[model samples]
Target: MSGVKRKHVTLSLNEKLAVLQRLDKGESLQQIAKELNVGVTTIKDWRKNRKDIESYTITIDGENALKHRKTLKRAKLELLDNALWMWFCQERRKGTPISGPILKEKAIVLHKKLKAESEFAASEGWIDRWKNRHGVRFVSISGEKLSADNEAAREFCVKFQEIFKENEMLPCQVYNIDETGLNFKMLPTKTLAASNESVTGTKLMKDRITVAPCSNADGTHKLPLFVIGKSKKPRAFKNLNPSSLPVYYRNQKSAWMDCNLFKSWFFDEFVPSVEKNLKEKKLPARAILLLDNAPSHPPEQELVKGDIKALFLPPNVTSLIQPMDQGAIEWLKRRYRRKYISSILEKSEQGFNIFEAMKSLTIKDAIYTIAASWDELKPDTLRKSWRKLWPEVMTETDQTEDQQNNDSQEIVKDLQTLDPNVLASEVEDWITECDKDCDSYEELDDDQILAAVIETDNKETANEDSDCEEDELPTRISHTDAKNAFDIALQYIEQNPTSTPMDILWIKKWRDTAAKSRISCAKQKSITDFFTK
Candidate 1:
C-alpha cells in the first residue's frame, strides 16, 4: 500500500493569533503561507473563519492564546501552566535554586502528576512558550519567604497592566475592596500569665464585626470603611451621635458581610463616595473596582451602573495577590490590638476588671479604633502591597524585613511593659486566644435569648408610646415575647408603606423563620419543664 498522506498540520493558538495579526496587517495569503510554512489553502480557510478564531482568542500569560475551555488540548495546557506556577512559587519559598533544566524536569513531573495525556510532549519549546506567555523572568529569591503563585501573580500583573492601558485609568480610578473579620474581644499578644505556664487562664471573646476597606492602587484615594454588626441600632450609640463615627455602618443577623448588604453598600455608599471624589479631583467618574470572588460579593449577573467596571481576582489566588491580604488588613488589626492593650492598662489602673471592661467596650469605641487604625496605615504600605499585582505602582522604598522586625519589636516591647510576665515568644499565641470566646454572649438557650431581646424591645416601645400619647392604635401587637420580633418586623412594614417587593419578601421569610425557631425552642423548653415537674 502507498504511505498514508499526512493530514493538515495543527497550528497552536499563539501561532493562529500571529497569523490573524499578520492578516489584519494586510499581508497577502501567499506571503503568510510561505512565512508560516503552511499551505495557501490553509491560510485562506483561517482567514475565511477569522471571526470564529477571534472568539476563541484570549490573552494568556501575556500574549494571545485560545481560551482553555474551548478544547481538551488547551485545557491541558492551562493545567500545566497552573501546576508549573504553583510548583515554582513553592520552590522559591523554600529558597531552592531554579534553572532551565530544572524547570523542564519539574514540568515533566508536574505533567505526570496532573495525570495528563502521557504521550503529550512537554518539550523545551513548550517551556519557552510558557515563559514568553507569562512574561516570566528568573530572579533569585531574596528577603523574607512569601506565599505566591508565580503564574497567577504574573497573570494578574499582565492583566492589570492591560486594564490600565486599555482604560487609560489613573491610579485613583483603580481600587481594591476586601472585608476582614475584626474580633472586638481581641487582646494584645502579651498578658499577665504565670511564668513557665503552658496555658493562660483568660479566654478571648470571638465576637466579631466585619469591615470592608477599599483603597485605590496609588493610595491617593481611600473609601470610607463599611462596617457590619449584629445590631442596627445598638445601645452603644444611645447617648452619642452615630454620625460621629468614621465608618458607614450597617447590620445583618450574622454580623457578617452578605450579598444584599454588599449591593446596598456598593450603590449607596461606594458609588456616591467615588462620585464625590471624582468631582473633587476634577476627573471623570469612572472606576474599576477590583474584588475577590467571595460568596458575599453579588453574583456577576448584577448590573453595575454608570462607568464602573467590576473585576474579580482569580479564584484561590486572591490570598496570594490581593493587596489587602498582603499587609493592609494585618496592619490595621495590629493597630487596633495595640489600642485595645492600652485600654486594658488604663481600665486596670482605674480598678475595672479587665474582662468586664472588655465586655463593656462598645461598638462606638470599636468603630473609633477601626477608623484610627485605618488612618495609621501608610500610603506607601498600601502601594507596596500591589507589587505582586501591579509592580509599576510599587515605590522603590519598599519596607525591608528589618524595618518590619523593628516595628514588631516595638509592639512586643509595649505589650511587655503592660504585662511584665508576658513572654515575647508567646505574644502571638495570646493574640490568637483573644478570638476564642467571641460568641460567649450568644451562648444562651435559644428561647431565653430571644425572650430577652423581645423584652428589651417591648420596654423601649412602651416608653415611646407613652411619650407620644396618641390615641392611634399600635401598628404591631406582641401577645408574648416569642412573637415580638415578628411583630416588630410587621410594624416596620406598616410604617414603611413604600417597601419594595424584595423588602416585603425578606420580611415574610424572616418572620416565618423566626416563628419556627421560636416554636421549636418553646416545645423543647416545655418538654424539659415536664420532665423536671
Candidate 2:
C-alpha cells in the first residue's frame, strides 16, 4: 500500500471488450499498447480474462477436496480463553518488553488455564493485536498493578449499584471521592526503554499537584472537596481553584478544605446536608466515600483500615478502577485552568498578572469556571466515577431529546440569537460538525493496560519556572540586594541548564531592584555566563 502506485488497474466491461476487439484485429502490439497507454501485459490480461484463461482447481486435503474443486481450510477455535491473553498482552506492553515468542507462550498458557481448553492460534498477529490494542488508560501508572483478586472494591462498588437499582436510589445518591496531585509539571507520556531503575523510580518522583476529587453517576457535577493546608501563615484558599486545590487550602485554619476542616465538613456539614436533602430516602447502605490513601488523612484511612466499617478501594486501582479518576477532577481542573490559560492568552503576558488575577476570583466565580467546562470534559467523565479513566465516546444517542432541546435553547440564549431561523441553522451546523469530529476520534480498547511513567525531570522544569515567577525566592548575595539578584539568577541558571527564554521573566524584577541601588555588576557577569552556559 505504501510503495505501490497502482495495486490493481481495471477497465470497465465495455472498455475491456473494446480493447480486446482492437487487439484481435491484428493491430501491432506496440501500437495498440501505445494507443491504450497501458503496459503490453495489460493487453494479455484483457484477452486472458476470456479466451486464454482456463478453469483451474485446488485440492487442499484429499479426493473429496478435488471433486468439490475447493481448497479446504482448517477451522480455528474461538478460544474463549481470550480474557487472559488480552490481560497478559496489555501488562507486558508498558515497556515490559516481552518478546514475540514469550508472548505467544504466555497466551497459550493463559488460554489453556483460563478457558480450561487449548488450541493452536496464529501467534504473531493475535499477540501483536492484543498487546497493542488501545483503551484502558485511567489507571495504568508505573507502580500500579492489576489483579482479579482486588474484588473487594468491586464488591463495594456493587453497594452503589444496589443503591441505584433498588428502584429508589438513582445515580444522584451515590458519590465517589479521591485526592490527586496536579503539580505544575504533570509529565506528558513518552516511550523509553523499560528499566528496573525507571520502574522503581515511580516512588521517587515527588513533585506533584495532589487534590481530592469526588463524583457520582448522577447527571449533576459539583466541585471536588478542597482541603487546603499550608506550611506557613494559614494555608492559602487559592488552592481550591480549577487550577489546583492545595493552592487555595494551605493558608486557612478552619477552612473547609483543610484535613481537620474537611473532617468537620464531612461529619458535621456534608453528612447532615445529605440527610437533610433526602428526608424520605434511606441513607446510602452507608455513605460510600471513595478516597485515595493520603498521609494527611491518616485518621480517616486508619479508621477504615481498622475494624471500623468504611470500605476503601484496593491499592493501585484508582486510575482505572476509581470513577473520580475518569474525569470529575480533571474536568474541574482543566476547565478551571483553561479559563486561567485563556486569561493568559488574552493578556499576552502584559494583559494582567497571573497571581493577582486569580487571587481576586471568589469561590463562586471559581465554581462557575468548573461548571462551564463540563461539556468540554464530559468525554472523560463517566456516570460512575469508579470506572476510573476510560474512553466514553459521545454519540447522538447519548442526549435525550429534552436534553437536546434544552441545549439548543441554551445555545440560542448564550449566543443572543435574535433570529429563530438563523439559530435553527446554527444548531444543525454545529451538531453536524461535532459528530463528524467525534467519528474520526480513535476508540480505545476496553482491555489494554497503560503503565504511564511520571518522569521527575519534567517536574523540576516546572519548579524552576514557579520559583522564578514568585520573586520571593531566596537570594545568593548577602552583601547587597543588587548583587543578590544577579547571584540568584546565576544559581538558578546553574541549577537549570536547559531552561527556555520565557523562564527568565523574573530577571526583570531583580533588575528593577538593582536600578534603585548600587547594583553589583560582578555577580551580573556570573549570571550572564550562567545564561550563556
Best candidate, TM-score:
1
RMSD of 1: 17.4
lDDT of 1 by residue, 1-533 (tens): 87965555678665765677667657787887876677888877777876565433422332332322222233347666655654554354344567787788877776665565556566877887676554455533344544445677678878878987898888888889888777776554334332222333343332568878899888878887888776676656554566777999887655667555777888887888888888899997788888876646643324244566577776557778888878777777666777776776677678765555565676677888888878767788889878777878876776544334454566577666656766666776655455444331122232332333235233211122221122233233322453576668777886797988788777777677767877887899899999999
TM-score of 1: 0.52
Over 4 Å off, model 2: 1-170, 184-210, 221-224, 227-262, 280-286, 293-309, 349-533
lDDT of 2 at 384: 31
Go through the candidates in order and give each one's C-alpha lDDT.
0.65, 0.40
Once fitted onto the true fold, the runs of candidate 1 whose alpha carbons sit more than 4 angstroms away are 1-149, 188-206, 301-303, 397-407, 431-533
lDDT of 2 by residue, 403-485 (tens): 33444455444323222233545544543332122110111132211111112122111121321233232334433665566
